[model samples]
Target chain A: MPGVENCLQEAMAIPGAIGASIVDYTTGFPVATTGAAPNEDHEAAAAGTADVVQAAQSRSLFVSAVPHDLLEDLIITTAGGYHLLRLVRTDFDSRLVLYVWLDRLRGNLAVARRRMQTLADELTTR
Target chain B: MPPAVAPSRLLKQAADDGRTGALLVGGAPGGTVYLVRGAVTYAESAAAPGVGELLTVSGRLAARTWEAALEAGAGRGAVGHLLYEQGHLTQGELELCVLGATYDAAYFALGRPDAPAEFRDDVRHWLGDVVRIDPGALTRESRRRTKLVEDIFPQPGLDTAPVIPVTRAPRERVSMTAAQWELLVHADGQRTPADLAQLLGRAGYATVLELRRMAALGLIEAPPPATPDNPDFVRLPRAHGEAVNRVRPAVPAASEAPTVPIVPSGASPPAPAPAAVAVVPAQVTVASAPEAPARPPKLARRKPGARLPKEIAAEPPEPHPGADEVLLKRIRTALRALR
Candidate 1:
């Protein structure tokens, strides 16, 4: 029963988490954000995350041949951090994405990914 | 750079003073921006769909449920909390929906360049403060979205004009976003982006942006020209490399002349004169031609206010067929006051 702000707060609690945000990929609007972000701008980080997500979702080549297959999470690892995006599924057209930026040194990528999946589900489920 | 004296300066001033209330922006498609102790909590525009419209239209909540929640909590400005507590929708769904709706409306509400804004102290939105946006951040996002739309398609005229799909596709293969596909299916050559937004319960700015993208891809009709003769004419996008000159030249003249009856004779003289109509043959020629010089006579004949009448009446008699009349009437009254 976590709300948007609560879910964002939970994401910030992840090990070595630098920033977290809920983004609507359709319009690239950040629903809520917490902690540090790239270039110190959460808005830009959210917009960039949306562009990446949209690129992955729209391209025919990126889509699997399996019917009804959906993209779950996207991970982009840089030298200093890991950018993880987990799609939030809903009954209607799904548009929300949970984005987390974790310090590569202190954050366990596997733990962070698993926790984010749970957070996304908790945020959506009543 | 932004102007030193924009209407949004009112928002900046309120934010600086840490005031809790609503700011009413007055003009065409005007809206109110709700702030809580200086942070923007919500915004709604006559041009975009509101949170209630989004929820009910998306089937996330029943119309009856939304009405019941509003009846119970609107006066206290706690509809968001009430719905969540009542188990009508999840907390996350309500927050995300409000945030999305607020940003969408803010694009039209706070982004206005010339609209005058007034702040009333101690007002609050029915949904309460589910999300708080920095005034500066909201303004920056609005500017970025505006620039993005221009970059996607420079034709601002197409935003309000009717979304008319081309008679045929210009390319053998075409691709479109799901939103664009929805727009194409709903477009009836009469519903402008704003009208379609209300009808489909989608954000107005998003609809405009998608229609502009479709125009750039040659998927929809080019916007009606600014000429007085064809004031309401919606030109279908022509097939690429088609016979540009050989098709029925009088077809445009015939269609353009009779569709609208509001055009004054002196203003739209091109309607009667076949010679004037010939210059605007195939909108693409006017589109593909080197920008300004190709249609010199047509451009020069245009009067400043000749198109006003048509634009004012462009919307259908009933803009929101599915929405409750009382709510819409209140909005209409507010919009009329601002206008």
Candidate 2:
């Protein structure tokens, strides 16, 4: 099973993946990191990401009669790269998220998504 | 080099060099305490009610009292002493208030020379006797208390504003510790965690810190940051709006299928699980479906004598269950299991 460090290594190994970090979304603080740190403050980024994920879930379009579960993943595509945030629900007090920066040209969106899900599961179990 | 007479000495010498007046002191026990200057300006304490807050929230004095006190000729004495003498506070209460205020004021005062001191000599002249605080001592004390509070509950933002719950909580729920529960109960919408500590007769910094810790753990909402430009506006609604949007979309199609179906195997019904899953599909389906059918009944019913109970009448005709209510239910259920 992958630990937090190995999880980051695995994410970095993804083609076009530049850096990765595990963040505690609830407090907006970084839990672990790899690659050159993102230009944004880690805490602010985590908090802002959580806020974005939350906002997307509650839009009038999404809030129908059904009760939804927690957020699973959020992806933001920019001109340069893709930012992928995956929420990992664990028994720990703070919720964790895997933040990965992927180069737009080198990344395979489909494979990255699958690998992230698997890595999140492994990290949480370990 | 005389072994660099420590940071404390340097701070004290700096204060003296600047000629900042007065002193305020505080601490937990025997060690060196914290101190602040005499003007008693810009004080905050996790141990006692802040002076202005104490005056405002205690119901003994009004804003006008502070204004009047501020304007009152030298007869009124210091605001801190007047509070004590007028049966508004006890000696103990006064001490705590002074301690908190002085420390807060001193915190801002230290290492800054150009900034105008909050309290002037005119104000002090009216205050009668100097509060007689040892500025250096109180500074040390405040620092120690702050550290203790942070150690217990690491998040900040507890001391600056009124305590307000971000979500409507259940009437009964369990907290991880008794102190956490006390912090919650004391969290009135108007008081910061530090103020709440004073009002509830608990340690100020400790309460603020613990409250923030609870907030981080999703037990409570952090008090919104203080913004002078729009003091009355609440930030929680915005935060709630954001939180509401972040959840995954619970599509109706997903809920239509039985959450945990017991399919028969080999021509025999599979043994029922020990406990049936509490299916929330009905709720999900209702929430996700279009509102076309729900709005008309209310529009039609309003035409005639509509004499439903007030509570039911108050509800929106369509009665869309709020996400917060659903989340609260889930939290309560989860907490119950922990108990």
Candidate 3:
């Protein structure tokens, strides 16, 4: 029931959330963003997130051996933050990436990942 | 001011003025930029696929469903909300589609410098405002995309030219994105990126960008440059002869293969006559393609002769263009053998 705006607001409510964005990976366009970008530039952060997701999804090396398997989530832990990207699969080709930056000390990775999965599901399934 | 400012600057000025309406740009295949308050909400161009085409052509929504939404919500300027409310598409999907379409259209609509922008008051897009983009972000992204295309492959004409996949795979292995695969499967060397964008329900800019990247990867064939003097001299690929040589060794002309297709020196055209060449004879090419790997030594020995044909073909056409009749007839004979 949550629209894109409310979804981003909900993402910002997550524990230790620094920023959250929804990006179309194909064009590297940021659809919506809330909170601070890594370099104070949401465009760069979104483009970077897309590049990482695209590289992981397309390359055969990162692809799982299991048939019909897909990349679920990617985590990059920095000195003080955790950048999590969860792929959102729609009815058509999967093109959306949900990116969240969390403060390492204050945020729990396990909880954020679970919440992101639920959010992605809700966003797709209506 | 000074004739007119650039389109992006005009959009910025509109945003700075806190205007809400449509900025109707004028030019070839120009489009309208929608703004609410100060942010760009949506954009549409004749050159890029719109939201309706994105949804229906992608098979995500039926044509009837989109038409129903248009009928019901267009008057209220709430087609997006109506689609979501009717359970045709999810809110996230709607937003993503709109955002993708807007960026795609805006790249073409606002990228043109010759166009003049005219702002009309109270002309909201019927899809409703699903997402708001800052003018600065949109302009920066457009500029970045343009630069990225150049950095990947600097051919400006490839955007409008029919996408021609190379007759021969450049190497034993190459990598591409799923989008590229989709474009390749549909590329008939007749459809430009704009045409494919509507047909495939993909963003026009994304299609062009992928095709450009494919060109950089040597997977795509650049169109032969059309010089006025020798317009009849289509820069035919030398690879077709090589293709025939490998496939039909029984060709009596196999020895003469090196003599046919008199391509000008330095004009090593990459794309053959797309459909005219009958290059998709999968049964023929597939069977012989593997022979190259097994008989590497034989091909290596013939590598020196490959250089001879170009030199021989180049000088002959200059003196008497009619001399290419023999070459044309050989290519025709090869084509007949291919069929």
Candidate 4:
């Protein structure tokens, strides 16, 4: 069974991955993080990402039908990088989101998305 | 009153005594710090933000937490012990809460020297006992929060101004945490985020830091530092226009006060003082003024033949009251005449 640290390591090993973090959405706290980002405060960053995800959910028209289900994934492609947020639903109304920052030039978006989905399934089952 | 011991001194004493409890209260000259047996509980400081404000403003915990904590049984393990038993917070969250409480207490204690401080020896906070903090952990968290504020705002001058939103391009959308949203909503045109946090029951430093971050993201604007010459920059009390009017004395009117005349005996007394009279004029003014000229002339010019015929007015009402009801009514009428 894949643990939080193993999941993060797998995400970082993905082609062109720069930084990755597993965050608890309910508390906006970072469970773990792996990255080389300079002077980045992980707690605040995790909180900020959770805020963004929440805002998207609020604004999305699809929110009403799926009341208790987790958000599958979010992808934002910038000029130089790709930011992916994958939500993993767990017991006790808890959820963990994996945020992977990928280099746009070297990353294959389709493959990365598939890999994150599989990883999310593994993490949730464990 | 006792000589104020440095926080370091208190920490060392607690460590040496192998105790995890101490209560700090008040500000400056008369502030009190009590070293307790189990855990620190029921701390208050004039300068530090209150726990009630912190929890409420964070939107994480409800205000009921304060009442629950305060009302818990008193004595050695009263408040803190009860909070732990209730399982309202994880051990780590509890520790964080206490650390935050200590900082706020210290801030108030050191900031204002004239305030008196009180410490109860055996009293405890119900929720506070569930968690423990190393002095080092508390200091580290405090430093981290301080650094966060500096990193976001860069300048400390904007720390106390009312947070103002700045307009930017639509493409430059900025995101804010829930706490940040609460801070903004509470920050009318007055009260710096720090002040708002204190007023709203949130962590002052965290609120300030988040406010700064919002400002950096161009989501908010920081006004110029307040000064004697720039009094407008000072946060004004949030007074509603109606409230201001209510408190202000009404301007004296130029019209003369009407006089009251006494009536001769057997005659009804002159109308009571105008002041005592219901000021019905004002109430009717709007309705009467507009219709006066239009309605009176129209009523006078109406022809008598225009009135409805008597037969139309006397049309019989639908249905009948039954015979039993008529007899009951006649009996009641006869009884009334007899009385």
- Taking all chains together, each candidate's TM-score versus the true structure is 0.74, 0.33, 0.71, 0.40
User: Which model, 2 or 4, shows the larger DockQ?
Assistant: 4
lDDT of 3 by residue, B1-339 (tens): 237667788888889999998777765446778899999999987668878777766678766677667767766778888998889888878877787788878887777676666777677877788888888888877787777788889886687667899989888998777789999999998987888887787778888888998998899998654311222222223434465446564343244344346444334442443332354354456666666445433332343323333323443222111224223433533453355
Q: Is the docking of candidate 3 incorrect, acceptable, medium or high quality?
A: acceptable
Off by over 4 Å in 4: A1-126, B1-69, B74-77, B84-128, B167-179, B198-202, B226-339
TM-score of chain A of 4: 0.86
CAPRI tier of model 1: acceptable
Tens-digit lDDT track for model 1 on A1-126? 888788989999999999999887866777678999999988788889989998898765466556667889999999999999999986433378999999999999999999999999888776
Tens-place lDDT digits, model 2, residues B1-339? 223233334446535654433322222111111223422233332344345444444443454554444344224445555645555444433443444344443432331222122211221223334244544554554464456446655544454546666575543664344457777776667765545655554434445555766666666765443422122223433444433322213333344335336453333433333222223444444463454333323222331332443324343222111244234434533453355
Off by over 4 Å in 2: A40-44, A57-65, B1-339
DockQ per model, Cα: 0.43, 0.01, 0.35, 0.04
Better of 2 and 4 by TM-score: 4
| Cα RMSD (angstroms) for every candidate in the order listed | 12.7, 28.4, 19.0, 23.4
Q: Report the C-alpha displacement of residue B308, candidate 2, in angstroms.
A: 52
The numbered model that scores best in TM-score is: 1
Residue-level error in angstroms, candidate 3, position A32: 1.7
Please provide, for model 1 over B1-339, each residue's C-alpha lDDT reduced to its tens digit, 9 standing for 90 to 100. Answer: 133345578888999999998887765566778889999998888778788777766677766777777778776778889998999878888777777777777787676677667778887777877777888888877787888898998776776677899989999999887789999999999987888887777777878888888999999988766632244222312221133333334456567676345355456764555555556666635554454233323323334554544435553232221125346634543453354
